[model samples]
Target: MTLPLNPQRVSVDSISKIKELSGENIKACMQCGTCTVACPMAEEMDFFPRKVMHFSQFGMLSRMEDINSYWKCASCHSCSVRCPRGIDIAKVMESLRLLVLRTNKNYIEPSQIPKEKLKEYPGIMMVAGFRKLTS
Candidate 1:
């Protein structure tokens, strides 16, 4: 049986929380795609930075819940540097991560990771991932 797609509702509170945390005007994004073009991790993201901003502007939190775009963000500030409206897209991504973490849900369980994989990954990468993915 085919399942019907239900559109996710917008949450004004989510939008406000993002603005409060990021201190950036998400509505300032004009869908210019500059952030997406400038993102080195865009290819790895399920949604491009521009689309993430678009969803964020509308407060589509449910739609964002399962996406890996924000988690894939490197926080490298490349998008922030290239934005025409001076909107720090990286901050927005960070806010999304914060929202998820506030619910006490971790994107990845540190304990579940294999010891060999942890040893293979660089310490800086592990540190960054823990900061972003863990509560």
Candidate 2:
């Protein structure tokens, strides 16, 4: 879904936080689509990497809030490696995740998992899930 841009709605604080967390110049992104092409999880994302970067550059945090692009990012660094501007896109994705996590809202709640399902899941998988989805 494409969100209409309103300059008045931009949050400078959110943009600063993303930059501080990622240590990447988000504005350096040229909307080249190179990162989108390199991302392995691009096909699974509701908003592709390029669009994510575009929204981020404009400080459109609300547009990003409900999207699965950041969550789906594998953090394989393929996008970073291929970026002409040398932006670490994976770190940006991590920063986005961190922003949500800082709000104390978890993507998954461990306690909500069924005991039977927990027992069926692998130990490493559970650990990884907790690390990724929990605050």
Candidate 3:
């Protein structure tokens, strides 16, 4: 089996900017995998929260881009709230999510998202969009 390779040319300044914004000392992360286990979405995430840390730590932020799990994050702050390294993992995920989300110009509707909905309806999505446009 072959593994996907991360792009080789990620910018250090971008990584630094992410770290600064997230308030996470990426160097402190030891990739202990504890955050992955603690995350409720680990089983479903293509790459766990810890993997996102590693990618950003090594300047492989390119691959971590557009990872669907990122959008799924409730920002429950569970990973950040539990990380032994004391890194703000949730903020880190949001930082990355914002990076990817900001890339698009057109608005995507809740009905347009191509993912399985856990609930009978997308209450969170609807509410979030409503609040965004209203406020």
Candidate 4:
């Protein structure tokens, strides 16, 4: 599927778990906005919860940067927990963020991590890096 932006041009690497950890079947989303209402950061987003899914489904990642909703998710999991579709919305966000990070990019302004701290948080990075489910 060649999207307008041509996600193939974007090259979503580093997110080996794109189809694993998230497990958020976009087909299940009905754009009901329940996830938005349940999201703690919906009020501060450029696009509501449903929009995020739309963007991801279409691979229009730039929309995520235009809004703070992605970062605001806070991984509260309220949306996923309450979703009638049982989609893992928070994990979806993480996958989006992970893919974005892969292309040497970020949705947040002034995005940077202190290199000196990489070794300090080895365990945290380890878990985040190997999030893929093999079985």
Candidate 5:
């Protein structure tokens, strides 16, 4: 007996885990391309919003990690609003980013910056920048 080739099924465990982490129905996506079309920064992504959705649905965890789409996402909610499946795509992107951020790897450290530059920047800017850079 031969099994049918289906890349999506190969990583069902990953799909389920991602769904649990993101709190979204990973199987609800129908690959309508609406998310990619509605994304404001789609052009900047290595794999657009729809492709990232597919990556999650298909349990392609390695593909998901290799792509830079999650980082490129602007969290504008445009894709989420346009999704026919009503999936919160922004939250999915947030989950992907969180997976990377929560691994004890801070993208930036405050001490690395010069005191003069830190003082020169506005308070709100520093706060927001640190928020994105640290965690």
Candidate 6:
């Protein structure tokens, strides 16, 4: 059965932005639930991986903030491997992270880090860590 979509909920610009950032065809997702089944953190996620894809594809961008399930992804590539459509589910999650981070909404503050530990980590690690934590 097909679900009806509200025109007001559809954001073509946001969908295009996600596609551009992740290099994915969001419309290609068939909502088969393979990604959810493959997600190791599925039980922990509020929406699971498959639902996250649907939220993006369906243009329900506002709901993404409430679910925030993409942050729970461990980037194990299990979902990508299981997806029959070959969607890079991991990249999709990253795109979501990037979208949030680009808005300057910091989830983690630099002051929260220990200065000594930060010094020990490599520059790339620090930057990547902040990117993940901040978003």
Over 1-135, each residue of candidate 1 has an lDDT whose tens digit, in order, gives 110122257877777888998999998889999999999999999999999999889888777868899888999999999999999999999988887788688888999999999989999989988988898
Decoy 4 TM-score against native: 0.61
C-alpha-based local distance difference test score of model 3: 0.67
State candidate 2's TM-score. Answer: 0.90
Error of 6 at 3 (Å): 24
Segments of candidate 1 deviating more than 4 angstroms: 1-8
Residues 79-116, model 3: lDDT tens digits:
88778889988888766655544554223455565566
Tell me the TM-score of each prediction against the true structure: 0.90, 0.90, 0.73, 0.61, 0.77, 0.78
Give the Cα error of residue 90 in candidate 3, in Å: 0.3
Candidate 5 clashing pairs?
A: none
- For all candidates in order, the CA lDDT equals 0.86, 0.86, 0.67, 0.62, 0.76, 0.79
Native-referenced Cα lDDT, model 4: 0.62
Off by over 4 Å in 4: 1-21, 106-135
Instruction: Tell me the tens digit of each residue's lDDT in model 5 across 1-135.
Output: 111123334577767666877899979999999999889899999998888888888777667654668777778999898888999999888777766677655545788989999889999978876776466
Q: Supply candidate 5's per-residue lDDT for 38.
A: 89
* Number of backbone-clashing residue pairs for each candidate, in the order shown: 0, 0, 0, 0, 0, 0
Model 6 lDDT tens row, 1-135: 111223246677778788888999888999999999988899998898988999888777777764557777778999998899999999898887777777766656888889997888799977876768584
CA RMSD per model (angstroms): 4.4, 3.6, 5.9, 7.5, 6.6, 5.8
Cα RMSD for predicted model 2: 3.6
Error of 1 at 46 (Å): 0.7
Residue pairs of candidate 2 with colliding backbone atoms? none
